[model samples]
Target: MTASANLWTHTNTEAVDARPLDADASADLVIIGGGFTGCAAALEAARSGASVVLLEAQSVAHGGSGRNVGLVNAGLWLPPEEVVAIMGEAAGPLLIEALGRGPETVFALIRDHGIACEAVQNGTLHLAHAPSGFRDLEERYRQGNRFGAPLQLLDRAETARRTGSERFHGALLDPRAGTVQPRAYCTGLARAAAGLGAAIHEQSPVTRVARSNGAWQVEANGHRVRARRLLVATNAYHAGAEGAYRPQYVAVSYCQFATAPLTAAQRAMVLPGGEGCWDTALVMSSIRTDAAGRLIVGGMGNSEGAAGAIHAGWARRKLKALYPALADLPFEHHWRGRIAMTRDHIPKVVEFAPEAYAVFGYSGRGICPGTVLGTAAARALLGAGAEALPLPVLPAYAERFTTLLGGYYEFGAALSHAAAPRLPV
Candidate 1:
């Protein structure tokens, strides 16, 4: 299949015209995968005066990076209490603190680099899918506030006013969160990294890695690039390479459908405040407007094969129900991606080898967590200081149930979409 039809078709926005890899090269660090984590590592390493080579099988941001929802929110899939509960008080607190600054770091980088990804800092709204969801948001707000999170709890009316929709009960807004055009952001980082003298190679899939005579030998695109350190930044979309490490996580699918730009009047009413919003349902939904006023609605779904059409239809109905003004608006873009989810829901950093690491499993919270963890990991990889990866690497096992679990999620998404009632707003 051509690259455009892949789950990450949003790459059309970032016009990086890099060619395929064809030559052998060497560097101080060899990073596999060119998504958020990989590119962030490349940028950080190059900025640190390390000779870094970043390789991607396809294009940069061709994976989940380009398929992102562009949400720059703090924390992970699990709530603060749950995170602390799973990782214990001290470790969880450190992680929360680190991620809390996720949006700050992201916006700073965007502004510094002038990446044109429609960077909007209007904040993000976490809407409640039900009363229980509101309670959950309340607890999260309390926990986040106690931990210095600048969060605001909004009632249903406030939520309606901000979102321009009355489907939600309530919401929690974090000023630290924002939105961006993801592909542009990734390409911008790559440009900044390359301008800083980092070597970035597209379509250079590293197929083998071996420690021969005390150096790491990485073979990709018929050439061997040797380095002292290696980084496996390929997350859920990883198709295993010969020598790279894979993080232990299940590949959960997240899909989105984008509508045509709203009419002038519709734009004035829908997401008029320019905030990115997501709900609290078990099968949740998200809403946001692009730089051109195109509304994007996303949720968990089977984003591949035969089930894609069903998900697409469900997205159509959901959009109409959410906004009566755009009831007849034809969706212009539909795409999906895999999110890495650990059984425990917290992200994982594995010490696969000496000076070699694999970072994955951000669940659905990519923007802030990915930015923070990727930046910190790059620092850690280069032996910068103690401020690298606040949480310790725990022993993890890749369960055999991952494929089955993925099938179940797909099954549920298909069944749920099929059962969706075509009710009018």
Candidate 2:
């Protein structure tokens, strides 16, 4: 593998030259973080005529939003019934319904804003990695159908034909989902928001935040930003801000390795229908093709850490296992991103202060939930009230043993990847 820079960063075209916040400024709303959620919120708030300012520690899409697998899935990793079970009938169904239209919200933004993110709304496949995994898909199919989702259960033969791999037993297909160049989408949102009069500052990390004189005073890059409301959309990449409450969640790492552009024959033979796919294994893995015909495969592990070599070795083995014909292809890009995982595997919108909220914990489903929740946060911050939000605003949300759990996840992923090659298909 060549192991160059991130494919998304290299391919992103929605360039925005937002300078650092260097002087005193004021806005109706101040947003921290410049990933999907922050950019989406800035766009919504600005379009709604609210004076908005967004600050980013790095450049736009510098966090998880830029490093994602680009799968714009419809809902959470949990099945519909499981969500209902954990969040209850009332709150659960509300989130489920809202996120079910997440793809629509995402694709609509792409279309309306003329984003060149290589959007493909064909669909996604949840492949069964084992017989038990197939059973899980069956239950998911049943739950999805009960919730009025137009899902299809494909048998082994159909799954093989669709994925170009005979390893899976079956698959659950969700037609409402799709993929995009994630970083481009995030930058596009920021571009659209800035065009609508929102002030965006990059490399201006917030250092302190305090409620003073019934407004938020945010210090960043030697500049003071006073706003009536504040929204912290940092998720897993949140840096400590004095007097600002940090979001609590377990941090899980996910990595991706992208091959060089495949030959036309290879592309035609693999994932020809252009559907994103992920298997149902415990240490979950994903496979998809980008617009440039590069095969991107991902798994749960930090690719830039101590276990990086193990993960890279496993990627080569995995590619050989999946497609023997393309075993020798080089991976031109390899990168990793962190995921904010909540205890119940649900995203949280915590009302940390009056008119100030901290939204995070997408649990691996960032693109859709980030867009939806960010838009809703903007509406609420602009006086739309709680009804405008998807999930109810919780007074507080906490997770115990975050550090220990994060360690456990990384250890488990490393062990699984080390053993994955020796396991039977």
Candidate 3:
């Protein structure tokens, strides 16, 4: 499998391999997918001294991992109170409390492994797109504060000052959140796992995986590998496989465009808080600066190729509206990738057999949640129970023909965006 390029085509990292599969191999575990989740699980399992084999249909970070918003945010898509209400007081609070520690886990790994990705730990701002959104932020703030989160709600002027954009009513700032160079980060995990003795194979498209004689026989590229446990980490890029767990999902895509690094004079006026920021618009958009000061602005992406031109045009206008000072600046890179979303905006894990499970769906929030959950899942498998895992394992949210939903979400986002004026600074 060859590596695919996306908005993360930065000069800082180059993909390491595109090799073939292992022939007649057996291991304690076989993980499918090469994105953040797969890499994290591989790293965790290998570090634990297990015999591990990670098979990627494509190169590492070849999916959403390479095309993410790069925000290492804390918590989940659901609010603290809402999570408590849904997962019930006991299980829900337990889940949120663990996820609340996500940023620290991510940052500590970055430091301990000495990964060279551009890791920024200052903070992140969640801006309210409307006054009503401010009320939502208020509730979230109270709930998060009660849970020991270091979050602050800022007024309109403070939000403008923090984001360097005056288009929001207010915002919730999470001090624990930060940003990173996503591809570099994913590759770092893979390298670390390999260093710890994991047998990671690229271009290994698993064509068949079946439970045979109480063990998993996984075939790929004319080779067969057997394992006691199997992990499926193919989320948004899952190629349909027979016997694979069907995931219920609506495809949501996000696109991004990056300007060349800002001049010293230009850098002074953008993201002065040195924090990543995204607004709570119906069709959300994120804005942030790279370590080199290149500003990336992203929003919903379209599956239709024709919509590319429209989104590209909209991005130009949105950039102008967000920062009138850089309205005339040239954009250097542009790309888009899909996000797997369930109706409830929660990820699901399904056990396909006695010892095999497939973990999928993260709606677009990939980095922290992906690693935190994926690593925990690997440990749970190794430990033979879900009790030690950080999240509540959701086993039965299944749907078919998920990839088709990509077009539907794109159409909806395109129509909604068509009716709105460009972002107003």
Candidate 4:
């Protein structure tokens, strides 16, 4: 099994290329990390007449943004009530309202920019793995409705009809959500930003960031970028010595497997509506089909870790269990990426200095929230004021026992996968 084989890389239609930065330059905003957030912010800031310089350590969408599940879902993994409780009454509702419009923001960008990312806006289904899961979905359905979301709870019969699998007890559908080729969407944003004179540089990893003489000076690949404002959007892939501050969050590993394009009959029977779905199990799993009719199944746990074989075996069993027709179909691609998960499962914006902000920790829902926050961050950083942001900018924030918590999650996922019932292919 080639651990680095990624479906998105193979099927990506959008492309972006750039040389590493080697000369001194300056801009109104300097963005680090060429993922969804950074690219989105670059596009927004540049379009708004602000000179932008985006420096990426690798190629665009090379991090979690490239390896995302592609589900353009609204809101966080936490329920609306949980988000409200965690964020409190005032800030919570604001965050929820902004995120609820996340899918809208994403799709509009695709439409306006003509990004060829196989954008699908049908909807997404939240499957209930058990009776308890159904209860949880019921609560989520209620909470979502109260927040003016057009959510629909489907019965088991309907769920089976829609998913073509009787494995789920029921499902909650969000009509606003959809799917996309994550890497394509990300690269498309970079391409669009670059076309608008954003000055995107690939392979330009930042070696140091400092406030020199009341201006932010970012050093990358032996080059310097002096800017009045700075935005550090490197979530889980923060590396090297970034002076002043670094993003703090627990790193959770998620892996995915994709089968070869299914036959027309098989594709018709499974997810014909092209709605992405995820289960309600404690160690949740996801299923969706791409434009080429390939089925993708993903779950928690790293595919390159010591328990790699266990995760591989569990994926095989899961594929067989979900769709017996493709029980013998081997996965054509296997890959993994790390997610920046905050303890409260909420994103953070740290204003570490007078005109510098670092945004990160999307928990697992990056597409929608990342777009929302990135756009808002651009607006705020370019004189729109911090009030334009979804969540209030904090002076500072920290998490304790991050390494221990990450290890705990990996151990629990491995144990669960190893204990799953074996099914004959």
Best by TM-score: 2
Runs of candidate 1 exceeding 4 Å displacement:
1-18, 385-387, 395-397, 422-425
- Candidate 1 residue lDDT tens string, 155-223: 999988988888788999988888888888888888888878888889887788888876788888898
lDDT of each: 0.80, 0.93, 0.80, 0.92
TM-score of each: 0.94, 0.99, 0.94, 0.98
Relative to the unseen true structure, what is the Cα RMSD of model 3?
A: 2.6
Relative to the true structure, candidate 3 reaches a TM of: 0.94
lDDT for each residue of candidate 4 in 1-425, tens digit (9 for 90 to 100): 45669999988989775678979999999999899999999999989989999999988999999999999999999998999898899999999999999999999999999999999999999999888999999999999999999999999999988888878899999999999999999999999998888999999989998898989999988889999999999999988556847889999999999998999999889999999999889898899999999999999999999989999999999988878778898799999999999999999999999888889999999999888899899899999889999898999999999999999999998988888774111
* Candidate 2 residue pairs in clash (backbone atoms < 3 Å): none
lDDT of 3 by residue, 127-163 (tens): 8988888998999899899988989999999988777
Candidate 3 collision pairs = 248-399
In model 4, what lDDT does residue 67 have? 95
Backbone clash count for every predicted candidate, in the order shown:
0, 0, 1, 0
